[model samples]
Target: MTAKPARDPRDYSWLPADIQAFIARTEAAYPADAVTFSIQQQRAFYDRLCADFDPPHPPGVTTEDLTLAGVPCRRYTPTAPRSGVTAIYFHGGGFVVGGLHSHDAICAELAEGAQVVLIAVDYRLAPEHTHPAAYDDCAAVVDSVPGAKVLIGDSAGGTLAAAVSATRGETAQIAGQVLIYAALGGDPSLPSYTRHAFAPMLTRADVEFYGTVRYAGGVAPVGDVTATPLAADSYEGLPPTAIFSAEADPIASDSVEYAARLAEAGVPVEMTEEPGLVHGYLRARHMSEGARASFRRITSALAALAAQAVAQ
Candidate 1:
């Protein structure tokens, strides 16, 4: 069974032209099979997208290479350093697709909007890298980034961000996390999961397929908690969180459950469910009005958290 995508919010009529175009084009490229494609194929697909996507660079952002867990990562820094607060961004594509290049536009926008350095990791994807490989790489990068930092990612990257928070010891220093449309688990009972089962881009089967590849040889963690941050036994000690969920996305429950857990743990958290948006709407920033709103919400949350961290 597949859940139907929610209709476009009535307000999308006021969205920027580029965002609207992005929605049309991306929607045309239906069924992003993140779980089914091989790493090579996925890489090629995104590479092509990057090649075609030429987003205007923010005034002073520069890109650099850094070593995390001994794996090479790409970092984007602002020309003007704002303070100690940093955003280590992970690109989403399940546990498989997406790279620094594909995410360059959004990262640059984030850097510009939040007025903070954005370190984007080019983590290895599965089924080649598999389970903990991606997680380990992310943890290493977070640990290595100098100064107080906020972890951020959309979709699969969002899942890893939460996982890293969970696995970090008392000494690991992430100040906050921003999860956008994260996958909390493989369970299909979540309302959004059942509602958007056949969502144009991401579907129920697509998630299952990705899970199989993500855990191919590794021992599957019991239930969604540990495997899914929402499923984690406790949210205590994890940094404050900001969740951005799309009303039409199947993974909406991930953010909702995570927000509830964070609150229960007495951890500070805020959640925003964008009406009528679909999965991966961040990439449609240029075409969809919803994407721009989503981006603004993301940066605003980061700025608010960064301010709190500064005050402390």
Candidate 2:
């Protein structure tokens, strides 16, 4: 049964069959109203969803857990690590759910893919810790990493990574940043938002709900850069950026607009729109061919940035 549209009609027919299957399996394993459940209940469902799709850690990759500057973090060190490049990843959970375990497999692969030490920050969640809590925790972890750093994140984590990159500017230590299916506070009225409003996996209502809970006031702060990267005063001084967006996700336009702004401000930025994919498709890398291709591209970008070989 297709969800009755609250705005424009959504067309899932354009998605690849594998992605459709991924969505079907996801919906079957996770309730559509999971977010509406109590916070504890929501986490239970999210954990189960993640477990169902969790892949084993990449061969030869090792992980260590630590509290970086008071924030719990998991670091992945592949067999061969980049000389000085360290990638810091923040997981996406709509600013509420998700923690270290949620994105372990993805982070492990990222570490191996880029051949660098990758640290996944388990930032504090919302309706409790709230806005700056997550931001501060991520910032602390970034500061903890020595030498050249590459910031990476997905969904809400993408927003945080972009925020961190913006603050560091075109600094020597900031090599690059990567955002995946991130909702960078793009206008909710953007074409992607409308077209994919009811696309499988995530919906417009879900976006609004996250926004409301992100801050203490039950709404996104009016003009905060960290809370909303799109609200930044300028994109200048930010380092090279690689943004990967899912074609069927409502927040895809955020990547488009962000890359355009970065280029306009003289920042080297690359945006890849993954066709037939939806938000949170990272878990589908092994399940969907399209997602696997996107993951390869993501890892390639990570490798290039680590080498500091991205066209400047």
Candidate 3:
């Protein structure tokens, strides 16, 4: 085989100083070479990396782990009265690694920030549980949550949230959707995909690998809304949506296209691109200025969604 080209050192000068330090700490903890390891090893490394940046759960937020509709879940309830709305969260792990515990701190902070009840689903992972399994688990929990709700997800979880919001039947009441650096499927030849094919944190090759594992058997049908929301025939009447994309992520175009489709279909939508950020920046919310700003935007969106649900 021909020798692989030497990879250039990623430029972090454009990112905030704090973010650069955060990235350095993360790299030291979980080397990029770890990506070549087995799934189990990757999962373990990911878990540790997440733990390293986990801030203490916000005060006044209580958590309980339970099974909802046969799907394992963790619920975060703030001390204040709920706005009669729920935020169903799916953790991102490329549908292979993350679980309830992996994203516990995130859920806790979100619940506190949004001042609403948050439910984090621990759906089955891949290579063992395939496509419809994780989606099914997420759908079940979304259906089980009481009253009007908003769907929130990141990466694979973002894909699940979008799928659930788009494919749910007429009766399901989704107030809005918050997609943070979501991985909605789209044409691989998109400009962002090609431009950021080898971006730091998440690369095009990494995304392709996850997609293969997510649908190990075979790819879903072209127009299957649940499998690929971007391919949905109509984005009309879905829900108000707020999509956040990292400037340097290969899948960033997925969010851009999805937002455009939603807007074209007359759905209220807002898209924000965080500059000098990469995939998985959510963990740096406490340390990085860009990540913190993104988190604030997410909190504002969730709060607005909850208010809208209450008004309805």
Best of the candidates, TM-score: 2
lDDT of candidate 1?
Answer: 0.76
TM-score for each predicted model, relative to the true structure: 0.87, 0.94, 0.94
Q: How close is candidate 3 to the true structure, as a TM-score?
A: 0.94
lDDT of each: 0.76, 0.88, 0.86
RMSD of each: 4.5, 3.6, 4.2
> Candidate 3, 249: how far from true, in Å?
0.6
lDDT of 1 at 157: 90
Runs with alpha carbons beyond 4 Å of true place in candidate 3: 1-13, 218-220
lDDT of 3 by residue, 214-245 (tens): 77664655777777788788888899999999
Residue 274 error for model 3, in Å? 0.8
Alpha-carbon runs more than 4 Å astray in model 2: 1-8, 170-172, 309-312
Task: Report the lDDT tens digits of candidate 2 across residue range 1-312.
Answer: 998755445667768888888888887767877778898888888889889988898899999999988999998999998676789999999989999999999999999988989999999999789898999898878887777888999999999999887765445377889999998999988898888888788888899899888788787787788889999988888888899999888889999999999999999888899887999999889989999999999999988988883333
